[model samples]
Target: MVNNKTCPGCGVMLPNKNLEFSDQYNASGECIQLYHELSANFIMSPDVTFRTQHAVDAYGAQHSGNRVKNIRTAFSLIGLYLAVEREYTGRQVQHAHMELAKRNIKWSSFILPIRPYALSVADVLNIVEVKRNEMLMEWSKNVWDTWENYHEWTRNICKSYLKHF
Candidate 1:
């Protein structure tokens, strides 16, 4: 029997259902997972000042989607070196998060999804840290190299970001 249940993630009616016998059903069998499209038109506004630490935090919370553009604008007028380094630093964090998605899986420790997309930069960093630690614990010798790479990637990003200040 087909349940025709609604998928929560995609909000679509799917073909998930029961197989004969004991009427056991799989709700997620026909789920349509939705990909989060990046925020649109993030750089339309004027450049925000990153002079103060508060401004930096606010920018991360409010304009994380358009980080590169804003950083370029704000720093081009104030400090070009900072602009370039920030872009480099931000891009690295973004890349590491993307790579984390493909390798994320949990059985023994059951780590949840990091959900790096569609979130503020601070939230993304926080969630990714949690997931990274979980992955570190679960990683065996076979996957140790990949895990180390991710760790080093984030560490370097932090170093680059700090260089801006």
Candidate 2:
């Protein structure tokens, strides 16, 4: 039997065979596997657009640590902010990401929480199919809430760069 590996970031355990994985973001092979499972739910759903966007932001933000690039982390947090605060749909957040990418907005580095996520893709996956979407949003919100230190910065950046979107 294969041994299980634990993700240092979110504390999820997955079966491991010592395969190569990204340590920069604390994404173990198991963590990526869990993410893939989460993605499959959205990918196979009729409401793919909204759920996909949320999964992207939620997973991205939850996984981002000091080892993650500032730009990518900023994108993740901004996406979360727009989705949760502004009630932007997944499509709108995607457009906002594109718009922000075009501008010269300076993305600031965040001092992410030591444990960036309390909930993992596994948590969402465990919920009943009918309530999965709600659980996904809850996961997103929980991840976003952990990055509370950067809320003002995220808000200001969106306010300045994404006002028209």
Candidate 3:
């Protein structure tokens, strides 16, 4: 019988081959480990323009729930919004985060959908190497779409804080 562990947060099932993350996200250690491997692929790429920065935000937001800190969840949602909606590069998203931080505005956590995401790190981890970036973006979009309930609030935060974005 194959042993598998499912992430309590994202519902990603993987062979029980890694330690679990102990963070507030309550992510399956295997899932977070897989995400690290996928992230390293983008971070180590020769292409400087790939949207690597968005990966953290996308993953975090997709995995967020009541147990996750409100501020952290807010940041993740905002970052995904800028990446998918504003077409902001990872670097631009970083700057937008910085701008929002300067305002010290309180971020309210929304009630996210209870549905498990259609795609997770596991989906893109095994794709053709050349198509990884494209797949990553698609993954990000899918995750962002799952959080559709907060799109309007996300946009408002950007408009209020990231004036130049």
Which candidate comes out best when scored by TM-score? 3
Q: Which stretches of candidate 3 lie over 4 Å from their true place?
A: none
Query: How far is 91's C-alpha from truth in model 2 (Å)?
Result: 1.2
Instruction: Tell me the spans in candidate 2 whose CA falls farther than 4 Å from its real position.
Output: none
* lDDT (0 to 1) per candidate: 0.27, 0.80, 0.80
Clashing pairs in 2: none
Q: Which pairs clash in the backbone of model 1?
A: none
Write down the TM-score of every candidate: 0.18, 0.88, 0.91
Please report the TM-score between candidate 1 and the true structure.
0.18
Candidate 3 lDDT (Cα, 0 to 1) = 0.80
Instruction: Indicate the worst ten consecutive residues by lDDT in candidate 2.
Output: 17-26
What is the overall TM-score of model 3 with all chains considered together? 0.91
lDDT of 1 by residue, 86-145 (tens): 432323433433443344333121121223213222232234533632221222111222
- Give the per-residue lDDT digits (tens) of candidate 3, residues 1-165: 999998876788889886846486658888888888988888888655557677788778877774788877888889888888878888888887787778767767668777678888888888998787788889889888988888898888778777777
Question: How big is the RMSD of model 1?
Answer: 16.8
Better of 1 and 2 by lDDT: 2
lDDT of 1: 0.27
How many residue pairs in model 2 have overlapping backbones?
Answer: 0
